[model samples]
Target: MFSLRTISSLWRTSKTDLIVQCQQQKQRLSSATFTVHPYKLHRIDEGPSTEVTCTRDQAINYYREMTTIRRMEAAANALYKEKAVRGFCHLYTGQEAVAVGIEDAITKKDAIITAYRAHGWTYLRGVSLVGVLAELTGRETGCARGKGGSMHLYCDRFYGGNGIVGAQIPLGAGIALAQKYTNSGEITLALCGDGAANQGQVYEAFNMSALWKLPIIFVVENNGYGMGTSAERASACPLFYTRGDYVPGIWVDGMDVLAVRQATEFLAKMCRDGQGPFVMEASTYRYFGHSVSDPGTSYRTRDEVQEVRRSRDPITMFKENIIQAELVTSDELKQIDVDIRKQVDEAQQKSRTDPELPIEHLYHDVYANMIGNDIRGITPFQRHKHQNTSKPCNITI
Candidate 1:
């Protein structure tokens, strides 16, 4: 057995500061004095082998895409100040890696379903910034043709930004079922927030996925809150990885792009190999509100938020990791930033002048067929008036 003194010293060095120090210290002493134990210390330098898959160009692309999401949201924030884009807009500022890293493990054929804060995922999946911006501004060119706004952007293989708490979980399972039925080599990735972890539908989806052996990955983007309430307050099983009791789960360091990618790649492979349902609880934080209208800082302490931002900023971590590994240079990263800013500026300019959704489209996407009962309330004349207008305003609730 290792001596208690040696074990105590090791435990002190290994555990997080947030860990219950006294309990951990006591446990360390007991284990050292009671039994022989063997363990290996791993270094961050000894990362997952497939990180090499992230080449210079891939790293540059990831960096640029993350930056564009960040800058675009910042622009949206600025526009909100100027009273341009209205209604509930949730920015994926600090949690970019949760989306970007997961996407690294997926293909265009794979499907993704997520909750309200979904701009990052849509953009990563190739939804043009012009479309997303116009959607935020309620222009017809937007992903949901301006009707869905921030909480409901959709694209090919991207299900939606579902507003209902955990409703998208089962929808993701259904998509996976379709993939299974067709024997398509594709997996469905369903994303949920820390708050939505408590929703009954999530567990229902978990049960369904396990029963049918669906190729689905349930990812909990633990951004620390369900609206104004923290995860600690909402979930009895606050350690979200274990929430999917029947499904195997992996807790990932969501702030590290490489970590998120490595973990996701592992989970994705498991699903691809017909391992059925898997869960990934990515530990991340967001810098924005439950929505654009609310100031995020009001509920959470700035110091707490800043601590995570300073230490665990995903974009910074990616840059530092790449530079340290000799994968990219500081100058190259700066150039990427420049290009991204220009693209964002161009997209912003285009969104402002875009026209609103035409009346035909409003009725077109509502259902496969426009039933008489659907438009029963609005008479022909009122419908004609709405249809003739080029821009529709105040769709916000």
Candidate 2:
């Protein structure tokens, strides 16, 4: 039996040792702590932690992913200007962190369906720069094989870049319900813009998803505008996360990649543990207009956008933090920048010059197994037979 003084001394030493061990583990991981915006939770006592500690590997990977997205968006902008990508083209220029962070927290098996501003998510979900750019330009090498253009890119588990505002929410809920029915241990993330926040169908999705206790997360990428109207002007209750009356919600700093990852991981855990669907609002900003043609300056000032770029650009912020932590040097990041620019440039030019899908291939990409499936949408007089256009793909995973 030890004396009380001796026991106290031993306890103190053990606690000190534990603290030192934690510190040493952090050092070993080459991790850096970032102070992010505190999450506001709805119908919950606890939320995602405000402090995000990212390891060296995570920082490097995230930086590369985000930089690629930014460069790709820049390429899309140039393509839009050149009229290579026609129709409604939306660029994910300033919202790279949201897509990159969300992807980091979720598995490829988990599903994602988003609105028209989907080039970034399409790339993160598995499409390469060439696939996305080619899809935007309606080329044969596109992920959707020139059928699904800028507003309808798709991959294995990724649903699409839905053209209809707020349409993907309920469809995503259905996917979640399918996951529930199949016991597949998968969850779905349905993302919509702040502009589509007020759609009555969105609330219906919220209600049904909550009632069913489905494993899904509803994300509102509030880039401050729905078309030309500001979020405040568009939504009566602009706090989108709180709009889910019965379902729990989380408000995340969308500009901070680590913060978005932390929040997504937290919410996804709850859903996997059978807590049902939740809502999240990623408060971010977009450098470009709602679409390419919006000029992006009619409603907002050029100075305001420029200020956000200077202060809160996700790539720059993450770079500075990682540099301060000694996880990466400035020269290494510069090299990475050059590499990404070169890759995107090469892909952009390829997509620009890629061959358009042949006229007879209109029936391709419509079905997976057309063995006995009848084409009800078409007439009996068949001009083009449905065929599988499987080609050896060279997509960068």
lDDT of each: 0.78, 0.91
Query: Which of the numbered candidates is closest to the native, going by highest TM-score?
Result: 2
Residue by residue across 258-296, what tens digits does model 2's lDDT show?
999999999999999999799999999999999999999
- lDDT score, candidate 1, position 276: 68
lDDT (Cα, 0-100) at 245 in candidate 2: 87
Q: lDDT: which candidate is best? A: 2
The clash numbers for all candidates, in the given order, read 0, 0
Q: RMSD of each candidate?
A: 14.7, 8.2
In candidate 1 the C-alpha lDDT for residue 43 amounts to: 18
lDDT (Cα, tens digit) per residue for candidate 1, span 117-213: 8888888887999878888888988877788888889887888899888899999999998888888879999999998888888999999899999
